[model samples]
Each structure stands twice: as structure tokens, then as C-alpha cells.
Target: MLEDFERGRVSAFFRRVADSIPVSDRPASLVITHLLAERPKFLEGVARLSDVAAVLPKPRSIDEGALRQVKAAMQVDELNRDRFADPEQATAYVESRAAGRSLGLLDVGGYFAPALEHLHTHFSGRILGVVEDTENGHQRYEELDKLHVPVFSVARSPLKDPEDYLVGQSVVFSTEALVRSRDDILNGRPACVIGYGKIGRSVAAMLHAKHVGVTVYDTDHVRRVQAMSQGFRTAATLSEALAGAGFVVCATGNFALREDDFARVANGAYIASVTSSDDELELSALNSMYARTPTEPHVVRYSRTGHYFYILADGNAVNFIHGASVGPFILLVQAEILAALALLASGQYGPGMWEVPAEVRQSIAATWLTYFHGVS
Candidate 1:
């Protein structure tokens, strides 16, 4: 049921990365966690690999049809995060599947990073390294006091630049679609983007392109300077950014908007997130402080002090509500992730954070350019 273009790209990626490693050094078993809704073809490709022990579906977003298709094609176990009441239970479930195996992890959004200490404590040297897919996850690994295994990140890789740009386009596309459905337009609205990372930069640029008065706020002074240099307005503080913003997009992939910051949002404004709710906004605090009303599907109104604001997708990533499809280009990042796992399986790296090797990045980029754009 997959498209030929997607299937071909994924196969070519696997073959290219597989050719670089001796068969003996490849991972014997793996546990992967990812957003099942975004790229089913890639997920299915990975699941069909020889040694996938289990698949953990990120509870936030999933496509049942894709999940079923992948399950029918393989005999591997499926673990749903929503099934567990606690992280420990999930970790225990993973441990159960990993019994008597040397396990590798392909993680997205740092789902398994917190459990690394526990996994390392129990599995010890039997655990291979982790391949993280997002900058949010990479930050989680960086915050750890000790890393039990090497973490190869494609988050900041040059290869991911295309995906990040597309992600920004998707965010704006979804936001405008939602707004248009309500008979509103983003043009001429005062917009604030609360992050200056790669995705944030793209979002700001897209908003500017749409004629929205976009102002950027970044915790990093360097990024703020960059934003100003790029001709977008800069806000030194969160309150200043939200002062009169009619549209707010949190792309920080961290807790960028907290309860205290809510009061500053302009009344009737639409607030959306680019990452998970927990990473971009303090949902728990907002739920407790404001009176929440379901304005419609994927839209909630939070009101207090006679002022109210709309939260898209109940504060979840707005783009996913509209399928968040960035198309076949995402395979580039997936290829880099596969290469990272291969490197980790080789036992050449020790416990610490590592970048996807230069050779791997170069190889993936070359393949992507040749296959997608007819570039040499």
C-alpha cells in the first residue's frame, strides 16, 4: 500500500547504510520509539529489518491503519505508551521484551532517554547506543548527569536542514488552514514565535512571507541577534513577545510558555505549538488556572480574568492535527538515523553524546541529492 517513490527511497537508504557494515556488527535486536503518524513507510521499512524486537508507538500521534499494516507484516511486539500509567511500567515492559538480547534504540523525541539509567543498570554492556531523531531529545540527553551509552543525534545535523524547513512550512500551513476554517486570516496579525532554532527561523520567515507582523523571542542572545539581523522584530523577554501578539507559535521544543506567560497573550489570540504540549507549553498549569472550553475539534478556549485565548490541538503540535506530512524528503533524516544505529552497533563508540559521523552525513546527503534532485 506504500507509494513506489517512498518505498524505493527507504530501500535504497537501508541498502546504502547496510553495505558499510559487516553483517556481524549489525544490531541483533532493537527497540524503536517514534511518531507513527508522520512516516509509516519509514516505520514499516525499519520494522521489516531483521532484528526489531519491539515497537513503541508514541501515544501523542498515530495512524491505526499504518500500525496495523506494520504489525501484520512482522511478528515483533508492540508497546503503546498510553497503556502504561507510569514511566517505570513502560520501562519494565521494555525490559521484559529485551530479555536475553543486546538491544539498540532508535528514539524520537527522547522518549527513552529518561529510562536509559534504568536500562543501563539492568542490561549493562548488552545495551547498544541510542539514535535520537529530534533536537528536543538531544537536549534531554545533554541534560543528563551521566550517559550510560553513546547517543548519536541527527537533531542538529546539516542533513536535517531540509526537513526542518519543511516542518516550518507544515506548521504555517496547518495554522493557516485552521485559521481559515474559522473565517480568519493570519495576514496583518501580530505574531510571535518563541524560539530561534532552525525550525523557529523557518516559521518566522514563513510568517513574514505571509505579511504577518512577526516578532521572535529567543532565550539565547545570539539567536535573538540573528533574528534581528534577519529583519524580524526581536523581544528580549517572553512577556514582551506576548504583549499584543494575536498569534503565538511555540517552537522552543522546551517549556517556552508557562502559566505566568498566559496572562500576556492577547485576547482571542490563537496559540499553537510545533512540538508536543509538554515540551512547548505548561499544559498542566494552564488546565488548572484557566477555564477550558472545547470550541471545536482540535481547538480549545482557555478563559480567565475576562480574557481568553484559543489553543490549537489542545496545545499539542498543531501540524499533526492536519497530518503533519513533510513528504518523502523526511527520508533523508531517516537515512542518517539508520547510519547512526549502524555505527552504534559496531561498538566503536563509548558512553557519551556523539554527532552522526561526517562520512555518514556526507553519504546520506549525496544519496538524497542524487535520488531526489538529480544532483551529482
Candidate 2:
């Protein structure tokens, strides 16, 4: 059953990417992603697209056979290279590739920030644009007014159809692992979710659905009121949110949680982050304060007040760390990626951060309604 779902998802993604390309003009596109190592289906779909020139994988644990298959599918001698070992190597390779012509960059998690800067510094006019996938990346892109290139972000898309759906589904899966660890973990316990954005709202809703008391913190007064309107308690400050919560979830896409916040946490509470940005938590400070390394993969057990505090996924996105995130529903997000790449390839968007167009958003939503749910 699982294999069948994966196959269909990959096929649909490939078809969308292929359909979006123009026959006469297929520009060179460089894709840098950590998802390739974990989600090979994504790599397979994009690699076969007409515009793909190179792939830079930040490997966690790469499947050698899958990597070979992706490389073979590229069907080009242009910019073929081994996986990047670090940011410096990636920067050098991207600069080398951008030497002659303008290139398109498709990235997740802001991993290619340095390389993009390198292009801006030396090869000022060599970039067509960039397509970013994560909310954290969108926040970073917003800071660069003189970026010299366009950046269209799926995370910042005004159309909330995909983000709302994915965030809700992904958080449910992420919280499952925590529940399994202790059957009655959430019963009558408080879970504090920072941020009242789409992702944070979903996380809080899921927690509330599980009968866990939820407290939300967002700097925006309107967002705070919004949380209150949803029947979830609101916290005026980060410190207030950390008071006695048994579970803490950071989904703000900002570095809102700090070492000081952790100091106020309940002795045996659990902490997790769902945002792609590593900065959401003060992880380095957390490690140094403990004076110990994580005893298990993606989990750290720190002793506090004769009990222990638990940190999930090393403060990375919990859904991804636990298991296949959002299961096959990730295809909806991949469809948006295909649309963004298509827009870039067609030279339709101008400079600065752009929103994913309404047409693309509706098309993807229609695809999901038709194929995934048989809703027509």
C-alpha cells in the first residue's frame, strides 16, 4: 500500500514538472536540497525535468543507488559534480556553474545563502532568480532589499491552501512519536506553542484536539487575539508560555525560544521544534548548559530537578525527524515547487520576493482534490 502511494505521488510530480516546461526553452536550474537524501522520489521527479542542470545534496544518509539514479537522469554533461561536503564547496561549485550564463536556484532551508551571496558579490548579473521552499528562508529573503535577484517563496505564498493543510497534517504525525513514548502523556497536560502563524496554529489545534491545554505566544497582538478566539490560551511573553507546560513546540520560524526560556521550563517537560530553521531554539546554549551530548539520535536527555527534560529531534523539525513527514501528502507541496520552477524557467517573475501566483496555487489544490481524495 505504501509503495503504491509513493509511486503515484512521484508520477504525479513528474507529470506536473514535465507539463510546466516549454519545449523550445529549458533554462539551467540548480536544485540544492536536504530532502534528496531522505526523499529520493522528489529528486527523481525533478532530475528528469528538462531544465535541471545540477543537484547539490546535503546528505544526512544518502542511498547510493538512488543518488546514482538521479545523476543518470540529469542527461547532461553540464555542471555534473559530486555532492557538496560543506557550504564553502557548494559556494565554489555554484560560482563555477554561473560563470557564463544566468542560472536559476531552487533551495530549501537557506543552505545556499552563501553561494547566492557569492553570485551577488562577483557575478552580480548572472542570476535569473531563486525559488525558496521554507518559511525560514522567506524570512531571510525579506531582509535583503538589494538582493539583485528575484526570490519566489512557497512558504510566503498569500494563498494559504497548501501551507495550512500540510502544517496540520505534519504536526499530527510529529506529535505521534511523543504520544507513543508515554500513552497518557498529553492527558490534562499543558502544551505551549509559540507563534500563531499557520504552522503554530495547526500545532496548537492538534494539541488541543488531544485534550492537552494549549498556550500560544506570538508578538503580534492580532495573532494573540486570534489564538484567544480559537479557544486557546494566550501568553503575553515567552517566559509566561514556558511556565509549567509539559510540552513546548516552537513553530514561529523565528528564534523566539532562548536559554532563559528553558530555565523556566517545568522539570520534566519536553521540547520540540517544527520550523525548518535551526535557530528556533537556542540549541547550542541548551547543549552547553547540559554539559553533555545527545545520548540518542535526534534526542537529548537532560537531567533537571531530579527528573529529566527531553528535547526532540535536536531542535530540528519534529515531523521529519520522527518518520516520513506528512506521508504522501507531501506531493501537494512538491506540486507548488514544480509550479515555482516553471514560473522561473519561463522568466515570468521580476526581482525581489514574489508570491506563488494564485493560478498555480489553485491548480495544485485542484490536483489534490481530484487525485488524493477523489473530490473532482
TM-score of each: 0.92, 0.83
For 1-376, candidate 2 gives per-residue lDDT tens digits of 2466757656775576457554344556777665333356675556444356567654442345656767667532222222232545665666566555557787776655545555655552356778788777777777754666778788766544445656655765666665556543566668888888888888888777777789999999999999999998998888888888887888877786776766777776777777543558876776545744465566667764455677777667777654434544566666677677767667766777786677777777776677667776
Please name the candidate that would achieve the greatest TM-score relative to the true structure.
Answer: 1
Clashing pairs in 2: none
- Residue 272 deviation, candidate 2, in Å? 0.7
Evaluate model 1: give its TM-score: 0.92
Q: Evaluate all candidate structures by whole-model CA lDDT and list the values in order.
A: 0.78, 0.67
Candidate 1 stretches with Cα past 4 Å from truth are: 26-38, 44-50, 75-91
RMSD of candidate 2 to the truth, in angstroms, is 4.3
Whole-model lDDT, candidate 2?
0.67
